[model samples]
Each structure stands twice: as structure tokens, then as C-alpha cells.
Target: ATQGVEENIQEVVGHITEGVCRPLKVRIEQVIVAEPGAVLLYKISNLLKFYHHTISGIFGNSATTLLTTIEEMHLLSKKKYFFNSLSLHASKLMDKVELPPPDLGPSSALNQTLMLLREVLASHDSSVVPLDARQADFVQVLSCVLDPLLQMCTVSASNLGTADMATFMVNSLYMMKTTLALFEFTDRRLEMLQFQIEAHLDTLINEQASYVLTRTGLSYIYNTVQQHKPEQGPLANLPNLDSVALKAAMVQFDRYLSAPDNLLMPQLNFLLSATVK
Candidate 1:
């Protein structure tokens, strides 16, 4: 492979580049322009479907074939500028992601992604030893597949209107749980990438919460609570966290507090408690 792949196989590479990589690039571009939520999810669904079909064509449900291809791709990455370009394209897309929280649920897109991930991981157990070539393949596949998902979360978080944010966050949270649940099924070497996503999701939740709070204005809420004490409106009624924005913010704030993260600074916690009660 160092000398480059066989010229015959290089022709097959051209086929794959034409059929899969080109379509994937178009889908990634779709994601950039698509409206947030269901439309965005639809673009993601198409991208994963294209990827699943491409990989399945090459591997054909055979664990051995899957592993071999991974090794081949990794090696080809070094020798083939086409492979190099593909990897670079994937990495650039990943770099654009920031992170999110949402039930957006086993959405069609989410389901497809998990299905592909599970199929790959299920192809072999982490405990099984592979030759150096196979190990390289595993690394290549893991990086190529999961790296973009973390970024997907970022895109989802960034694009949503607050109205959809909390529910979406909840779904995203469960998606994280599903991702971690599959870790035991993959090679231990892949654990680091898996863990990075877990950590990134935690940060996503925090960022989502922060945005919600900022939108609702914690200082304003706190002052409002102070000036319009429930006691002042006793008997007839009580001052309430009645603003829809405040309620929405509370939902996200409570979510961050509950999800695993160090996002909530103590001062904000103090301000939140004072504002609510």
C-alpha cells in the first residue's frame, strides 16, 4: 500500500468516489442549508443511508470483509490521494461541529446512524485480537463513522428554536445513553473516541442550558421575583414564573443541573434559586 494500491483496485476506488463520496458531500452541503429539525434530520438520514449502503456493498455482512476493508482503507489513505481527500473532507465536516441536548428521539436519522454503528461494532468483539492490518482498519472505521456524530449534535443544538430545545435535548441525552451502551461491543482501542463523545455530549447539554438561561435573562428574572414577591399578591394570587421564556429556560436549566456536567456556576445556581422561590 505504501507503493500505492494495485492499479485495478484503483479503478474500483474511482467507482466508490463517484458513487458514495460525491453523494455524501452533497448531503453535507444539504445539512448546511436545511431548515433546523425535521428537515435537517431528513438530510442526515439520507447521508447515513448513503454511507450504510456503500459500506454494506463493500463488506456484505461479513465481519472479515469489514475488517479487511478497514485495513485496506487505512493503508490506502496513505497511498491514494483520493482516500486522503475523502478523509480530509470527513474531518473538515467534523471540525465544524460545536455540540446539543434533545429528544429529537430515535429519529429516522438517529436510528440509521446507530444501526450503522452497531452493525460495524457487532462485526467483532473488542476482546478478539486482530493482526496489525485489522487493527488499523478498525481505527479507520471508528474514526470515519463516529467523529461526525458528535458534530451532528452540535448542529442540532445550534439550529433549534428554543421551543424545540428541551425536548430535543432530552432525546439527544437518550441517544448518548444508547451510544455508551454499545461501547462494550467495540474494540477497547475505540473506547477513547466513544468517551470523547460522551464528554462532548455533556458539554452540549451545558451549552444548551446556558443559551436557554441567557435568552430568559436570569438577572431580570431574579429582580422581577424580588420586586413582585408572592407575598405582595397574597390571597388573590401570587407572582409566578409565568413568562413562557422563563418556563422554557427553567426546563433547560433544570436539565443541565440534572445531566452530568460542571456547566452550572455557583453564582447562576444562586441566582436561579432566588429567582424561582
Candidate 2:
């Protein structure tokens, strides 16, 4: 009689636990499906983490069903948060056919994307995701969000002149690099962005040098020297390129130097980096 009563009591407790957990599971599912934005997802995950520990301690083995459900929802929210943010950014970046402006500033697409990234990073900043997991999270965010934005910026500048294109890309990339630098766990990304900025700066420098040489009427002599390598006889032996022409080019260059405002490409005036300018 005693053994039978004990088994009956256990069965009743199991049913009661199931009945309570059923409604909770439904509510959690509803919350996960109804919410939008990464911030809400992070909040939900944090809530679940609290409940996970509390329920584990209070109910012990009896709350296995509830614990498993909570864990599943936690993982689901994290996965959705990352992928949804990626989809949101990718779609918004190319929503229209906006082009790079005449002043070589950052394109409209880049500005919008940066705003979105700021929101996402703010949410990430306040999140309670564990330390061990953050590195992986940062890598995923970098690949999913930053990479596509950079690609879009590149594509948008394809039709511009060489100097204009480089200036636009540099402006767009510099803004992105600065934005990322405001947050932690972005060192690798910063280094990558720095490399791109340097490459474009090199292009801008070359373009500016060529423009200066052409404006001052020294390109012909410069091209001649390039074609006739040092392996050829002394530069004095080169035909039609001489000291008189060189002197005339130098005077033109000096005149422009005196009025330095007109020397650089008008487009380069909009370069974001002051040092580069």
C-alpha cells in the first residue's frame, strides 16, 4: 500500500510540472516570434539566461522540459539576431540607385549603412554575451555586415574618374574605419580597413602627381625619360627633351606652387582624412 501511494504521488507531481511548463513554453515562443530588432533579441536572451539558472535551482530535475525549451529559445534568438541583422543591412545598403556625389564625399548608401551599424553596435555593446563567445560573434558580424558594405561602396564608385573614385572610396572607407574604431573587438577589422585606405591613398597620390605633371606641361619629358631607361645613354642624349623645356616646366610648377589653392584636384579637396588632405 505504501509503495503504490508513493508512485501515485510522483505521477501527480510530474503532471503538475508539465501543466505549468506548457504555458511558459508557449509564451516564450510567442515573445521570440513577435519581437524584432537585435536589441530586443539580446534582452530576451538575457531574460532567458536568468530564468535558466533560477528554474534550474528551484525545480531541479522536475523542470527538465522547461529548461530544454528555454535553452532552445536562447539559441534561436541568438541565431536570428545575427542573420536578421545581416539581411537588414544588406537589403538597406542597395535599396536605391544613389551615386557618389560630385564632391567625392561618401555616398548616400554608405551613410545609411553606417547609421544602421551604429544601432547594431550599440545593442551589441550592452549585451551580456559571454567573453569566450564574443570573439566569434565579432568575426561573424565583421564578415556579415562590414564586408558587404565595403563591396557596395566599391561598386558604386566604379563609374567615377580615377582620382574621384579613389577619393570617394577613401572617404567611405575612412568613415567606416572610424565607426568601427569606436567599439571594442574591432582591431583585425581596423587593420583591414587601414590597408584599403593606404592603397587608395597611393592611387590618389599617383593621380595627383600625374595631374601636376600634366598641368605644368612636364608629362612629355617625364614620359620620355620613363621610356628611355637609364640603361640608355645620358638623359642629355635624349631627343627633343632638353634643359630649356625642363626650365619652362619648372617655372609653371613654381607659379602653381605660389597659388597652392589651385594645385590639387577639386575632388581631392573633400578627402576625409586631414593628414591625407
Candidate 3:
């Protein structure tokens, strides 16, 4: 079973990178080649088909997959009936996981963001003809997917308890910074975009630090004081009233906050700012 699982994962990764990446590279090359307009159109169509197929494989029976497939083929009226059938499958999948709570960890959010980035990048890279327009559309779609994921990461960072959470939070922020840099490359006078990206990064850092200090560290202090003065009031019911946990949490928080700001943010910001001008 383990071997089978490993093989399945490898297959999935291979399908994504090859089915998606190679075609994109080829399409980019095609754009450089001075081909007939009809030939270029055919190539673009083929690239879109490959993208849809690869995405369909990944999503399996999920509702998102159906919607994605429909959007992918929407321009081709001949595929409308097929897309409708896929939409039905997606609706059925949605019924199973309706009203699922927001995913509250770095891994879940990060993985989703990465997958979306890969898909958008693949599509953008594979297109023939007007590069700038395709790039702009790609950037907009990426921003739409990333904004919510970033918000979720901020919320998750506050409640998490493990060192892994901190690492994941940092990684997610870095990914956002990288993506925003790509956007800024497309336009220089996008001051509003620059401000938004910077603000989001600042919020991410501040929220993470505050959560660590209050919930992780200060909770320990509150707990210790409560335990020592148990007879003082109803506050004794609070968890982590122990002095030991309080001290340890505080120490950990201090250690983390003392580190230099990760360099990736500043570098990405610079890149974006330069591109905009």
C-alpha cells in the first residue's frame, strides 16, 4: 500500500510538471517563431486542451474541477455539452463537503496556493501571440486565488502551537511576496498594488508576532498567576495556568521575535517597485 501510494504521488507530480510545463515551454517558443496566424491559433488551442486535461486529472471528481473545466472550454461552443456533464459531477462532489470550515494551517493553504500558481504560470507560459495581455490575465487570476489564502494564513498563525506553524507562516508570506513581485513586473505606476502588497506583508508579520506574544507567551503568565492564586476567583479554570508552560512559551516567543526580518520581503518589494517605474 505504501509503495502504491508513493507511485501514485510520483505519477501525479509527473503528470503536472510534464503535461503542464513542457507544453508551456513549447508554446512560449512557438510565440517566438514567426508562424502563420492559423497555425498559431491551432497551437494555442492544443495548449489549452493540455492544460485542461492536466487540471482535470488533479481535481478528479471535485466540484472545483468541474467549474475549472467548464471555464477552460467555455470559448469552444462545441464542448458546452461536455462541460455541463462535468459540472454535474462537480455538484455531486460539492454535496459531500458542503460548509467545510476554513482550513487553519500553513500546509493546506500553501499547497493550494502553489497549485494555483503552477496552473496559472503554465497557462501563461504556453500561450502564443500577445504576451503582455496573457501575462496580465495570469496576474489577475493569481491575485484572486492568493488574496483569500493569505487571509487564512494570518488567522491560522494566531491559533497554532507548533514550531512547524511558524515555518509554514514564513513560507506562505514569502510565496505571496514572490507572486506580488511578478505582478509588479507587468506595470510600473501601480502604486496602489505596491502599497497593498506591502501592507499585506506587514499585516502577516505583525499578526504572527502578536499571536505568539499574547496567546502563546502571555497565556503562560496568566496561567501561572491563576494557579498560584487559585482561591482568588473563578479564573482558576483557565488552561495552562502552570508557571513552567508560561515561561517556556514566553522564551520561545522572544527568541523568534528577536530574529532579523526575513530578507525575501525586502528583495521582492524592491523588484516590484523597480518594475512599476
Candidate 4:
């Protein structure tokens, strides 16, 4: 009879403890999912840590049920913090992103994206990531925020004319590169931006060269040579390469060489990079 009485008491104690912890677990989860910002998550995690330590001290630190609940809540909050912050920025980028203006200057999308980065970087002081993990976290934050913006810019530029598209990309990428330069631990990102800029510059240079060749009347000869095979024996056979056409082309070429600056494409004036112009 005594054994039956003891078992009943233990069952009652177990139900009471579970009842207490169940409400707490629900409340912690609500706080974790509902909280809008990472800063708040850090504060909540710190508070949980304090409570965890206090409980462990009293309960001999043997992973008591309450302590275990607190630890799980702490981890959940952290995971939610990063996920929430990234999702918020990604949604904003999709909504407000825009294309570059006519002058090849930074677009509305680039401005807003840079402002978002500034705000995120400002919050780094309050970050709760451990010292060893901070670098990795920083990289993730940049990739989550910046990579999408880059892709959006690329997509937007696709609708532009060939002459303006590469220039706009260069301008947008240049601003992004400069903004990142003001921050630390972004060497890899800088290198990637630099590489992209160089590639665009190469395209722009090729376009300009083609324009010059066509304007100076040399593209006819250039294309003929490119299309002609060695076996074709191209010297005097082609009517387009006659003496009169050659003289006119040479005159146009000489005129371009004498006043090259005056003959530049007007669109080049809108290019943002002075070094490129």
C-alpha cells in the first residue's frame, strides 16, 4: 500500500513540472518567431542565458528540464534572427529595386541597397555571434544582401540597348565596390567586383573600337579579310576592295586620326568613369 501511494505522488510531481515547463516553452517559441529584429534576439538570448545559469546553479547543472528548455529557446532565437534579417532585406530588394538612369549613374535600386547595407553594418556592433564565428557570419550577411542586388542589376540591364547596358553595369558595380571598400573584411568581394568591372570595361572598349572602325570606313576591309580564306586569293578580285574605295577609306581614316576627340560618340559623355572616357 505504501508503494502505491509513493507512485501516485511521483506521477503528480511529474505532471506539475510538465505543466509549468509547457507554458514556458510555448511563450519562448512565440518570442522567437514573432520578434522582428536580430538585435532583440541577442537581448533575449542573453536574458535566457542569465536565467539558464541561475537555474543550473540551483539545480546542480545536470541538464534539468527547465534548463534544457531555456537552451533550446536560446538556439532557436539565434537561428530565427539570421533567417529573419536576411528575408526582410531580400523582400525589400525585390520590391524597390530599379534600373540605372540615362547618365549611367547609380540607380535607385543601388542607392536603396547601399542604404540597407549601411544599416546592417551599423548593427554589427550589437551582433551576438561569437568572435570566432563573426567573420563567417559577416560573409553570410554580405552574400545574402549583396548577391541578389547584383543579380537584379544584371537582369534590369538586359532591357537596355547594347551601348548603354555595359556602361550602366559598370556604374552600378563601381558604386557597390566603393561602398564595400569603406568596410573591412571585404577583400574577396572587392576582388570579385573588380573582376566584373574589368570584364564590362573590355566589352565597352570593344564596342568603341567597332564604332571607330565603322566610322573610319575600315570595317569593310576588316570584315572582308576576316571572311576571306587564304585559298581565295583575295588581292584584286573583290570589287569592294577596289582602288577608289581604298582611297576614300584612307581619307576618312586620316581625318579621324587628325581630330579623334571631336569624332567620339556622344554617348561616351554620359559614362561615369573618367578613366574610361
Better of 2 and 3 by TM-score: 2
Q: Candidate 1: list runs displaced more than 4 Å.
A: 1-103, 126-136, 166-170, 184-221, 224-277
The most accurate candidate by TM-score is: 2
Identify the leading candidate in terms of lDDT.
2
Give the per-residue lDDT of model 1 (tens digit) for 239-260: 4455675676677667756763
Error of 1 at 222 (Å): 2.7
* Per-residue lDDT value at 118 in model 2: 75
Per-prediction TM-score: 0.34, 0.81, 0.33, 0.69
lDDT of 1 at 157: 64
Cα RMSD, model 3: 20.5
Residue 20 in candidate 2, Cα distance off native in Å:
5.6
Candidate closer to the true structure by TM-score (higher is better), 3 or 4: 4
lDDT of each: 0.46, 0.78, 0.46, 0.74
Off by over 4 Å in 3: 1-105, 160-169, 179-277
After TM-score superposition, the amount by which residue 237's alpha carbon in candidate 2 deviates from its true location, in angstroms, is 7.2
lDDT of 2 by residue, 1-277 (tens): 9999867765676577777676877887787787566556656775676677787777666667768877777777767763675667686776654688877787777787777677767666665666556567667767877888987888888898898889998998999998999887889889999999999999998998888889998888889877887788788777656778788888998988898668788778898889778
Q: Evaluate model 4: give its lDDT.
A: 0.74
